[model samples]
Target: MDFYQTDPTLENYWRGVILFGRNVASYKFALAHALYEVDKSGSDLVTLEDLAVPFSRHLCQHLLHAPKQITSRGSQYLETCVQFNNGEITQDKLIETTVRLGFSNVIDAFHNVNAGEIEKRFFLDERKTAKGIRLTDNFFQLSERPQYQNLVYETNARWNLVEQAWAMGVSRNLVTVEFDEQEQLLFSHINARRVNITSCRDSLNGYQKGRCFYCFRTISLIPGDSELADVDHFIPWMARNEVNNINGVWNLVLACQCCNRGEAGKFAHLPSRKLLQRLHARNEYFVQSKLPLHETIVNQTGNQTTQRKDFLEKNWQAAKNNRLFHTWEPKAEGEATF
Candidate 1:
């Protein structure tokens, strides 16, 4: 699915960066967190040294929890941050190292997605003038968005999911993502121990681009919000015996409450063919992301794109043939988002 085509809002572009941008290391996420922090200060121009403080601090904080930040072997900048975390290096020295190494690639590549640059540029690179990067109006405007805090939570959650996948060293075929209904979290078994990865809503919202799966309305990560997102199984979980891995990421989408279980919600009912097509596109987004969900979905569904599509189609056909689920569509269908 074309993310920009459905809703080309600034918030959607930012979510694209966090959700779909390739992660050789987690520098993108740290840079994102740092960008939000710097924006909160109401500063337009930030020196590399200033940005490094939060950038390195976030990496240091996460390093304490998950040591493997990169898919590659090692990162000198990360090593410096590790030293600082271990009290083996001064903060000043850590900042200096970060200014030199941390911004080497993330700044240049931050706006890139799907092999092209996004139309909206959040920050302008100004290192050639020795002034560091300058935040654009787009950056500030995004901070004012109602879902700003949700974006922040989503970024951190995505970072945690990637880092956990990296640290665990689970083979692509062996990664199994389990949902905790009571806690509303996604986790996996590591050495027979449950390791909570992240909030299911936070992780899935990025792929959904913060919109409800059915109506395309903006959803919230915060609690007590009327538009708060619900983790709906695209294919109802009641068919667990008929389908394998009914609660897998392939069958999950974030929907607003009104479209999930309200009077017109799709409770235990089959969605329209158009919605099924959207679900296929949404699952393809997860596979293209190459995140932890990528492996889990591939394992649960199929590896090849056609094979995955066939899996969903087969399940959908079986449910329809059984005549057990009545078809349901939203009363007010918004623009197609997937």
Candidate 2:
């Protein structure tokens, strides 16, 4: 329940994990075993809080046999929490209570963390709780209210890209530019707004409401809220080798920041037009149906995928010739009608 703050050295280590992998799921997958295993002299574990409930560091101590600092802090705290100079097994003894009690709360915490959108919903500072994420309370609470169920269902149907944009905005979002070795501090020569990237995103948002055309996560909540809507390339920029082609409007979607930064670029170079067409067609079908959109995706995925593919193919040559994913626009929502 109580803890020491992360010192500079350990703070850098955690930041490296955050910056490099760009998501907590990637970080957790990377940190699994070292977190639990015993070491010869000491372990690399440290106590921290669960995300929303930051004050509850020991909330999940049941998982750690003997939860203590893994990284270095000061001298006194280490002696009491870690190796006993007397060679007693207090370290192992404390952690054992969890294993002995049959409480799965601790391990389940780890699993819930790795479960996608569940992790990105809030801050993960451990002085809070050793737990790493915030659950979708707003999303769920809104969903349960019949008045908002339709909106919530539609929102959750496209949650992945939605969450991704929110994550990019909340975390480290990179702006791309062609720079010479002399260009330092990035902002010196970078015309971020003039790049007209926002205009591109706006165009898409003009159509899709700044929500991701793919997933519905809002893309611009975090600090500095770097253009949550990004100009995406339907084709890989590297593959095309043409700058003009890279920023074309036809090639773009005003998707949530997550789709722009994380999803589209990671697994595929650009999102398939077929996917968009499917998303659109499916959305239209859901709107007409008596059932919620979430249920629609679940029930009609196979058919939607096929029709979507067919629709995209019919427009395939035109979309490719026009270069569809090259630009982006902000999302439009509520009464702030753009």
Candidate 3:
């Protein structure tokens, strides 16, 4: 997230930032309104995603420019759509049609129009190429399941093009672990951390299914917040507990806000503590981010406590070595990974 934090006053310096996403939100809202109109007018023919294209192009324009927009050149309707929408379109439309049509019934008509109509009406006389088609197809695949993990991963993979820097962003918004000299292994009790018990049940269940691993009480992402659902160490921080060897990951397990707090400082589940050790030793080390929530830290590999200092390290070199981001989704029958 901090990767592009240049001075906000850098004089349209944001011209180069990859932030068409912000404008896309507006376009999506416009599309939604259009869809609502279509439904009310007895024409539920077009779907929400179809209405998203024109505004998506409009989004590309804010970021890329007119000549560079994805629809600049094309042989087919969808292919033409991609020509102007692919991440390269610049904010060149001195005056965007869609922007002018803000909150208008025509925009609603755009939202209600199907891809076939739009393409046939606006994208005639274009040569559709496989390259452009693939690009457009990729976007749809991603919108299907916008898992933050999958999005972040694919973004790093395709966009990184060089050094993968996922560890930082992950910690900033998703999941992370820390260790630093300034804070000599400072640990907090499982109770110290605050969380929304009713979190993102959708994402949590997607990861942990039913039944809490700790209490087996059908845990879920505490609803409301989008924070990581960490498998915590229920015992004291700094690994102080020794009875039943409670400091390990095996003792740790899935815990909701009530269980984590209701028994804060107090021992809850043996598995909660042990699970961290096991998960830690497994390939579950939290990758610290480059964006500084705190100081510098590295992601732990499967084993670090047993290894010699400096020899064991935590860096995103392997995970992000030559990162790539792909919007993953099942293809229509047999599409290949681009």
Give the top-scoring candidate (lDDT): 1
In candidate 1, which residue ranges exceed 4 Å CA deviation? 170-172
**Tens digits of per-residue lDDT for model 1, 1-338:** 27765778888899888888888889999999998888456568889998999999999999998999988888888999999988999999999999989899999999988888999999999998965999888988898988788998899988988888887785645567788877899998888999998899988887777788988887898988878889998878777777777777788889888889899889999888888989989888878777687888888788898999899999987877765888888855556666
**Order of the predicted models by TM-score, top scorer first:** 1, 3, 2
Separately for all candidates shown, the number of backbone clashes (residues 3 or more apart, or on different chains) is 0, 41, 56
Q: Residue by residue across 169-224, what tens digits does model 2's lDDT show? A: 32223322221213211111122342211122222331233345555554442225
| Candidate 2 lDDT | 0.31
Off by over 4 Å in 2: 1-198, 221-223, 241-246, 263-270, 276-338
Model 1 clash pairs are none
**Model 2 vs. true fold: TM:** 0.24
**lDDT tens per residue, model 3, 116-201:** 12221211111122111111322233234323222222222112211111312333433222322232222211234622211222
The estimated TM-scores of all candidates read: 0.93, 0.24, 0.28
State the weakest 10-residue window (summed lDDT) of model 2: 1-10
Best by TM-score: 1
lDDT of each: 0.85, 0.31, 0.27
lDDT of 3 at 247: 30
